[model samples]
Target: MGLVKIRVEGVSKVFGRDPAGALAKVRSGMDKTRLKDETDHVLGLHDIDLSIRTGEIFVIMGLSGSGKSTLIRHFNRLIEPTGGRILFDGDDILAYDAARLQTFRRRKVAMVFQRFALLPHKTVIENVAYGLTLDGVAKPEAFRRAGEQIALVGLTGFETSYPAQLSGGMQQRVGLARALATDAEVLLMDEAFSALDPLIRHDMQMQLKELQGRLGKTIVFITHDLDEALLLGDHIAILKDGTLRQVGTGSEILAAPADDYVARFVRDVNRGRILLCGAFADAGLIAAADAPVIAADATLESTFAAFAGGAAALAVRDWDGRIAGALTPRRVMEALARI
Candidate 1:
């Protein structure tokens, strides 16, 4: 609920020569598939309305061709929209000409790709410094800044290694480092961790969460995996066939799905992992609370581990260590059942 960093209003994209007619048809209640089949116009997005908050991880998730990638490209104007407009910090992005758009891309935002887009010939240090170099930072100063980012990403000694010499995860870290070196206000990550192995992907997810907490960068992350979105996103936007289906926190999405598509999508999800400790706590049940105090932000997984020895209820405390609410095993199970 801070200031809005990016606002997308009534955004729609149709890829074809005669987009005006197709868009008019769409507004008249025509669907995307029928339009494509009957009019030969492809609908890449339809009325996408989103507000990305400052310094928060806003995740856009859907299967391939769902317009998740296309929607994000508009943040940096990579793909010109057939209709609608986007606002960044109150400035109209769509109205920017070539020079202003270039400056916006260089200073306001940096992107990390699905593939590790590192230079095969350049050393890791060189790749990380490339963005700064492009912005006209002197070589010595650029290297100094890039070296700090490389260390921040835990790739200190391997700065001399080439992309081929590093592992997939390491290369991905290089991509992250390169983006960080730019010192941009926002990070647009399009399925950045999807290419890694499952274990490595999870590790990267945790690292990104920690880094976000420390750096407070506004990150717009794209993903196809529901679990990854639930784990990493402060707010999640679900897209289906180029249309937005739902937008809310993970718990909100789980407790109340907006439509049948969303309901079926989350029907088999492991809800226990995503539910937080705050969900199970009820202040009125203080007398029933018989266990140790736990942090309000702790997840059910950690609660289970902490109370593994018994079935006692726990007392939840706020950041200042003051009693906030009471938690019970039964309440936790009941919350999971609702999901």
Candidate 2:
């Protein structure tokens, strides 16, 4: 009926000599040395609660050591949670044994790492088919499927090329193809575009957004970049030290940050770029009249550029050229001032 793919409950992960004990801090005690000395045993994640809807691109963002990676890792059981539960489509993923988990990874969930995890010697087709092969898909069938996936990621003619022959961005595209080949419902991307150069990164971000828009795959995207989060996420969840700081749409966070940390994170952002023309229009500032209009879904950045000569109010007309409302530079500037 609807895609409500990944759901996470009171998930918590702790690395320490006594992981179970570290779930909650105890007073200075007999095992102080054990708790203090072991670094990995320390709690990496607190009681984290989140629900990722199917087909929605949910972004998890935080700085380094904030448990962003750890929290994401828990989704696929790469790192087992010391406490709580993870459910995939109402199934308790934690209860799945190796075979069931392997099946799940193959068919339902796929991950793209920061480092393109393609086999260096394998050709692009071979890399994309690796998952299918592991899942017992026929060699020839897997190869054919891989070819289709390669084409989907815009690596059509390079199917026979090795990972080394491709640029970093291309290699990452290969990685994406490999994941897509599985037809996985949930795509967990851990800083997928962080490794690319600025220009390349922007291209990759746009590509991923386009791909997601077309494929409608549920994505749990992890990133340290606020701009990236705002650009890609349908819903943004800000995590600080393994705890959720705030969760909302990009504009909601930009318009009203839940706390100082989130406020500071988006403080310098240009709201004109982050918010849509509809937000300003809905503020009831625009006087409805026949004038040039931009769609409600258009970005402020794009809409502002349309009014480059400094118009009083650009009419937000519909597709049929009927008057909807107006957008003013003053409203845009006011919204941007909140960031």
> What is the lDDT, from 0 to 100, of the residue 312 in candidate 2?
68
**What Cα-based lDDT does every candidate model obtain?**
0.91, 0.84
For residue 319, what is the lDDT in candidate 2? 58
Q: What TM-score would candidate 1 get against the native?
A: 0.92
Give the residue spans of candidate 1 off by over 4 A: 289-291, 305-308, 317-325
- 55-112 in candidate 1: lDDT tens per residue? 9999999999999999999999999888898999989999999999988888899999
Models 1 onward score TM values of 0.92, 0.89
Give candidate 2's error at residue 338 in angstroms: 1.9
Report residue 56 deviation for candidate 2 (angstroms): 1.4
Residues 91-179, model 2: lDDT tens digits: 99999999998898899889999888889988989999999999999999999999998888888999899999999999999999999
